[model samples]
Target: MNIPDIWRGLTRSRLFWPVLTLVALAILNVVVAPNFFSIQVKDGHLFGSIIDILRNGAPTILVALGMTLVIATRGIDLSVGAIVAISGALACTIIADAPDGNNPGTVVFAVAVSLVFSLVLGSWNGLLVSVFGIQPIIATLILMTAGRGIAMLITEGQIITVSSAPYKVIGAGYWFGLPASIVIAGIMFAIAALFTRRTALGLLIESVGINPEASRLAGIRSRGIIWTVYVFSAVCAAIAGLMISSNVTAADANSAGLYIEMDAILAVVIGGTSLAGGRYSLTGSLIGAFVIQTLTTTVYTIGIAPEITLVFKALVVIAVCLLQSPVVQARMHRRKAAPPLPPVPSGTITTPVAAETAGVAS
Candidate 1:
């Protein structure tokens, strides 16, 4: 309620900057494209730039949601993109070769097969890092490099297109006046929120991330926690892959989910998860994914060059990152001769460094 308390609260809110950035982008889009905010009912489904952003960003949001937990476990998964490729490749291949790709049963079976494969791949990463004591980055890097090759082998270096109506519904179809992708992402987010907050898993993950030795001493199964996160991350990526390939009805082993890992990482960082790992905010990551998708939409709306669009997006991201950085904020406050803001409150689920410095780390 006091001035400093309010200031600290504002500064520590993980959702603040990402939400502000998203709103700013929306305004900018509206300025550039007056109809950007307009919503229309097409075949009983809502359609608009805003809806498109949510629909398109759903996969990234799903991936970032899983990455948030992985980072909270003091780890990362660079192979998400590759997993995406493999998932799509496997599913599409199976469907393509099916006697009736459009059969709902066939689509279901394909999806199941893809997810099972993703689980195995995720377990491989987990085994290397959790069981063999390999560093997370390096362990995941192995898969990151080789996963594409595996996908290529599965697809035989060809793009496999399918025409499964049920499969298409997973990505491009509309349901109940909204995008199916959005619905899927929302369900995934809700399940994650419940699995973590409504249970003790979230705390244990954070405890391990902050201090693995301490968590182990307390009898927490640190290895299992780490392995479970990796597996979950992979499964999330597989879902994203299904969404991507389903939207197009094609799987390109070379390009399916290409570079999505970087986008997911950026979304997580922008949403306030620290690469160093600890506490995390799935809400922030969700907003951050929207921010990214909105930025991409803005590029075309504002008539930015195709070649330089990435540069523009990168510059914006850099600016946002700098603005949200504590080091930069501290310097700005010092220049203004303002008292330093109080540290983020204990048990706050914002990011890593705040928790790390507040003795969350050993």
Candidate 2:
């Protein structure tokens, strides 16, 4: 495609900004550090420390996939992190309370209970948002605050430890030379892609996101779509909780998923979804998650204070937003329309749009 057509196509995609930003960041990293791309296997296990990032990032990617759907409908679920806390607590409690030495079904039972609880929490968000007309952020935040307390009640404000082998394997084991968490993330992405891209539901979601009232007038069950997304988001969070608990062999009532909602939200935004709603892309979200994971990994590798990573992350998010924004892109396009300036006084910008958005975040 020519520049204008390509620009328009990208503007139409949810993943465009995130992918472009990820490419730029990766290029910068490779330029600055020669060892950034090095990898080796040790002890029959892939030993590049970057693998650690991919492993840890899996859960957030899973959660983001569901969150993308929710946000697509002009809604947000602040309760997801809380749902993770709830799901982990419920799972750990069941495993701990299993019959002393013969709880062979502990894994099965715990997962079942966890799913049921997540479903109920999701339904609650949907009910308040749909049936009662509560704003999504308010509806989910109410649960977000209340859910943490519920998690503590389940665990009595304590972390729960377990020894179940299967439970541990779900989060800690691997298949086909990949970490289990990574594999689960892949499966979740595939399912999401199938639902959003291969089925008619994707169109419905985009329609509702673009214009819910119009969708209602056109005979779509907009409320049902809204409810389904919240439920799916909860289920995804539950899976993340399970993987998280499995990794540590324990679940912390207070910190299991603390503030992860922010990261997921950033991932969705970086992936290029409009906060106002509509056009969603799972591929973009996946790439966005990878970039976030990579940024975190890069910050750690460079020996910067870990705390500084958040600052870098915030900058990167801002950059991505500006790069993908129509306001910025429109200006970039205008630069092509103007005549090139001579190698002049070396201090003045020849293009106004570039000068306006170049250093400024959109």
lDDT of 2 by residue, 39-136 (tens): 77654556454567789899889889989999999999999899998998898888888874125577888989999989999999999997798999
Where does candidate 1 stray beyond 4 Å?
Answer: 1-8, 333-362
Candidate number of the best TM-score = 1
Q: What is the lDDT of candidate 2?
A: 0.85
User: Clashes in model 2: which pairs?
Assistant: none
For each candidate in the order shown, give its overall lDDT on alpha carbons: 0.91, 0.85
Candidate 2, run of 10 with poorest lDDT: 41-50
Model 2, TM vs. native: 0.86
Model 1, residue 252: displacement in angstroms? 0.2
Top lDDT model: 1
